[model samples]
Target: MKTTLVLAMTADGKIADVTKSPPTFGSDRDYAHMVEQILLADVVLVGSGTLLDGNESSEVREPDRALIQARIDRGQTPQPPQIICSRSGKIDPQLPFFSQPIERWLLTTKKGSLDWIERASFGRVLVCETADGSDIDWQAVKVKLAELGVENICFLGGSELAASLFAADFIDELWLTICPFIYGGSAAPSPVSGVGFTSDLAPRLRLLSVDRVEQELFLHYQVEKKSEDIPPT
Candidate 1:
């Protein structure tokens, strides 16, 4: 399976403001670009924080005709399912995300899945706990996604989830839109958060492309994987 992380950050590398609100700084062009990326994926994977932060829904509620036709031509669902990753499975049932038209799935630990087992909120509940039982095992999650025939994943994140996937070396590509503003607070979140990597252990990237649209710069990068990092079958 291929996973692509898509984010729009400030020039100073902040994905959100200090308040951690849903980013509204990106241009309309940037949003279109993000939707394009999402349309290419078989499913959209997002952290619980991102989903709950702004009461967001992953459904493409008003997709353009061209966008719908593109998916149909590719033999894909008009809108991909969204898989929410939450270690605690503590999502609020009242959140508007549960009422969206799109199919919903949950990626969480075994204990976390218990509350959702009898709920109709999610179409599928995947349990893949780490050895310590502290978090979702992303590697195992990857395998499960593969078994479910998820060949392409669009990861819409809130830093921590991005960090986990990067640490696991599961991210295959990145699409970053650098907005014109500079949000420089330490509390502001970046494209990747959590215990960050040192220079030696950092994942390398090969520049794929760059596009300038108005004041924003859209950057695409392919994550260079080491030989030993090949994913398990």
Candidate 2:
């Protein structure tokens, strides 16, 4: 399956205010555009934090949810199958999201020791392999998602997952929204990705388009590994 990683950051490159939370610390337009792209996606790979914090079908508003619902009504489940990438299956069992009328898949490395909550039957528990050939076993993840019939995966990643994907070269494209704001706290959280920094001294991105909405500026970049980006792993 092809993956598109979507993110919203500030002009100074900050995703959170260093607190690991949101407002996305940006402009309204950034949020709007990000939400719009998410609605169009066939599969929304949710980050564990987003799920644990109680996001529901209604959280994604008009036009977006409306567009998604139209597909659901047309015999195409519009909720886009929330595939939660959880390291450990510790989400609240009775969370309204689990009961929401949508297809949910929880991809975890373990079939965690949660006995009170029976999630095995509610959704698919994907077990990810830890290794692959000299290559980074992209197959394990791809094959499993393909088995679930996922074609386009829109990754709603937190920092850690975003870093891992970028390092693994698992991301095909990136749609980043750079909000116009400078969070100058020495410890302010960055809105930018972490992968491109470690492997290669420099990250490469092709400028796609730039849009200004309200008080924010949205910049889109395509991330790809170049000859110089490959590290001596």
Candidate 3:
């Protein structure tokens, strides 16, 4: 599946403030842009941190008539399913996310899926782990997503998840909205957070387009991948 990492970061490259509070910096235009991207996706992917911190439903709120009609014409459900990635699967069942109208799915490890399996909170619970059992095997994840008919995925992240996908070379594109503010603390988190990559091994990108609206700048990039890195059909 083609995966796009969509994020809004501050001018100083922080997605969140030092306290890691919910993001409220993106402009109205940025929000519209996000909705547009989400509409193009077959499913939306998010890290558990985003669900816990944002405390918001993944549904497209207040979609315009045209957007709603477009999905109907495409024979897609009005709302896309949201698949949350959590290695621990320890989210509180009472979060507003559970009550949302959209279909909910969970991607976790064997041990992590036990509680969710019993609670029956998620419509589908997928257990995929690495050989060492340290993290999700993203290579396997790609195959599973394809098997489930997920052609396009919109990844709304909370840093760590973005880092993992990028490191694994599974991210195909990026839509980054650079906000006007600057949250310049060391504790502040950027779009991709984890152990930093070395220059030689870092993923490369080709600039696709840029749009400036007021103080915010929307940038699009295509991630360059080696032929060998791409998985076979």
Q: Quantify all predictions' global Cα lDDT against the true fold.
A: 0.88, 0.64, 0.88
RMSD of 1: 3.5
Instruction: Report the lDDT tens digits of candidate 1 across residue range 63-89.
Output: 565886799899998889899999999
Estimated TM-score for each candidate: 0.94, 0.77, 0.94
Candidate order by decreasing lDDT: 1, 3, 2
The C-alpha RMSD in Å for every predicted model, in order, reads 3.5, 4.8, 3.5
**Model 3 spans with C-alpha error above 4 angstroms:** 227-233
lDDT of 3 by residue, 48-152 (tens): 999999776557876565886798799888888899999998899999999888889999998788898977679899888998776899998888889998999
The digit string of per-residue lDDT tens for model 2 on 57-174 reads 3236455767767767756565677777666666676678766776777666644424324545346666674643122235587887787677778887776667667667677778
Q: Over 4 Å off in model 2, which ranges? A: 53-66, 69-75, 94-96, 111-117, 120-122, 131-138, 192-196, 199-203, 226-233
TM-score of candidate 2 against the unseen true structure: 0.77
Error of 2 at 80 (Å): 0.5
Give stretches of model 1 more than 4 Å off. 228-233
* Total backbone clashes of candidate 1, pairs 3 or more residues apart or in separate chains: 0
